[model samples]
Target: DVKVTQSSRYLVKRTGEKVFLECVQDMDHENMFWYRQDPGLGLRLIYFSYDVKMKEKGDIPEGYSVSREKKERFSLILESASTNQTSMYLCASSLVSFVMNTEAFFGQGTRLTVV
Candidate 1:
């Protein structure tokens, strides 16, 4: 079965702490993404990498960064955590389909709270 593994199911950090959220996929998908879900705003993309060593900023990438050093792993970095950054972070991966973008398989999600 295709799988995406997130390092933590829940995380708590203080303001100004540097936080790292790790994700690994066993399916070798070409596209991986990090998104944050909040109460009213819905899911807002933070970062995405389509290939190793490549990354693109998404809608809400201000306080975040990402790394894709290998094909199966993607890491999201919160440079400095803040109260407003608390949310459910979801990691997802999908194939680079020729017809259209394939459906993404998501991890269980990491709930983060910044105090």
Candidate 2:
């Protein structure tokens, strides 16, 4: 089975602090993604990487950046934490494909709280 691991299950940060969230997948998948889930707003993608050293901005990339220097690891960096940025962050991995049939396997999510 494919597994994705997030660095933290929960995190507390102060406003304006820089935060780093890490994710690793064991399946050697080609696609990795980071998303933030808010109430009612659903999951909003923050970043994604399809290959090493390659990254792409997703739906909500402001104040955030990503790194993918290895095939199995992806990192999400919050330049400056804010109260509004407090949400459940999810890391996912999937096999690269042109069809959307492949489901994204997710980690247990990191619940971040900014005060």
Candidate 3:
């Protein structure tokens, strides 16, 4: 089964603090993505890495960054967490061949509350 694991199910951060959320997949998928889901706005991609050490900016890359040093791991970094940044962060992974229209398996999601 394709599995994606996220570091936290919930996180609380003070405003302006740096936060890191880790994701690991055991399926050796080539496409990894970081996205934040907010009410009304839907899922907005933060970043995505197609391969190890390669990254691409998504729809909402501001205040967020990502790293993919290994094939199985992807990390999302919030440079400065703010109250406005409070949202549900979701990590997903899929085979490179299924980049379009294929369902990306997701983590349980990390609900971040920045105060």
lDDT of 1: 0.94
Global CA lDDT computed for model 2: 0.94
lDDT of 2 by residue, 51-111 (tens): 9999999999999999998999999999999999999999999989639688899999999
lDDT for 55 in candidate 2 is 95
Candidate 2 vs candidate 3, TM-score winner: 2
Candidate 3 residue lDDT tens string, 47-94? 999999999999999998888999999999999888989999999999
Candidate 1 vs candidate 3: which has greater lDDT?
1
Clashes of each: 0, 0, 0
Clashing pairs in 1: none
Task: Estimate every model's Cα lDDT from 0 to 1.
Answer: 0.94, 0.94, 0.93
Tens digits of lDDT, candidate 1, 1-115:
8999999999999999999999999998999999999989888899999999999999989989998999999999999999999899999999976368469899999999999
Where does candidate 1 stray beyond 4 Å? Answer: 98-101
Per-candidate TM vs. native? 0.95, 0.95, 0.94
lDDT of 2 at 33: 97
